[model samples]
Target: MSLTIKNLSFSYPDKAVLKNISLSNLPKGKLTVLLGPNAAGKSTFFRSLAGLVDADYEQILINDESLSELTAAERTQRVCYMPQIFSTQAMLTVFEVVLLAQKQLNSWSVTEEDVQSVDALLKQFEIEHLAQRYISELSGGQQQLVSICQAMARSAELFLLDEPTSALDLRHQLQVMQRLKDETQQRDVITIIALHDLSLAARFADNILLMKDGKLQGHGETEFMFSSPLIEDIYGIEIELFRNSKGSLVVTSELK
Candidate 1:
């Protein structure tokens, strides 16, 4: 699977959110990280891909098929997008919510496979205990993990996750990233995640797409795109990367 975008632009009557942005072919079996500051059009771009926002001139092709021509149901079957903010006030249990999402793309009647799959997914995130818990009773971090499971249950070819680990603690954040990487490779899904944590992006992303001022500043391998100069330019903060005792790349911002 692959996604190609060309001459993509969007506006909101008062101001432009994305300027003539274009990205080359983004192939499957890899996690691509979208990094940028706030209000930098990262979420807007994901909205367009999810068919929530209208584009002025977008030629988005998924596996050579035109995304713009697909119907709402067709898009849902092919792409799963998890927004940054979500309401956790639902009265349904975690398992029920996931079952509902699966039913949307599959059968209405719950099957043994569905039950087993949801159970396993919850276990993967170490949240199996929350399966029967009401969604309204879970904390923000728990809800986020449940939302991620809902998106994963769809098994879409393209997964667009915005700030997926925003509310998680350090341990869960690492777990989520590792799980996403393993799932992406195993399923051969084209997973694009919008992240503010440059260190995590650098550690997990197979490729990186940097955006600034509604435009793509760079797109390539993580090692090539992640440079002090580029980070300083895109984030407007001087930074440096160093190998810790564990030989992991760590990003540290330098105050001017």
Candidate 2:
């Protein structure tokens, strides 16, 4: 499966946000990281993909099928989106939220397989202990994890996550990225994540989509997109790229 966006654009009454953004053939079974400075429209782009915002585009296609043509139920079944902010006021257990998400996407009839699936997801995120805990009572990081679990519970062709690791600590950040990568590959789904941490993105992303001022600045494989010139031009800073002993790309930056 793949995603294609042609001449995509969006605007608020006050100002334009995305300006004729066009991306082609974003492949499935890979983790693509969306990088940008604040107000860069990364969130807006994800929202457009999720059909949460109205945007004009020549086409937004999944496997040659127009995403815009899909019904609300069809879109929900095909696209799973986890926004930066998650609702915490829901007086439900972590397990319930995840299970409900799955049921909403698939069927209302609860099955033993569904219950097991929720349990496995909770265990996968190491949050099985929080299964019985109320969402409102969890910490921010815990809530973030639960939100991700909720997203993971859904079986969708496309996954769009915005700043999923913002509330996570160092360890959980690594854990979440690793799990996301694994899930993307195992499920052969298209996963696009918006992130601020360059190092984390470099370490984990299979592809990079960089944006600035509501426009796409660059898109390519991880190594090719992390060149000093592109990094400096996009962020307006001096930067260095090198390989660590493990051969992982490392980026260091300084104000110009």
* Candidate 2 C-alpha lDDT tens digits along 1-256: 5999999999999999999999999999999999988999999999988889988999989867798788988988889899999888989999899999888846668999999999999999999999999999999999999999989998889999999999999999999999999999999999999999988998999999999999998899988888737767888888777899999888777899
Per-residue CA lDDT of candidate 1, range 8-67, in tens? 898999999999888878989999999999999999989988889887665888878888
Pairs clashing in candidate 1?
A: none
lDDT of 1 at 202: 77
- Model 2 lDDT, full chain set: 0.91
Off by over 4 Å in 2: 105-107
Model 2: how far is 50 from its true place, Å?
A: 0.6
Q: Give the TM-score of candidate 2.
A: 0.96
Most accurate candidate by lDDT = 2
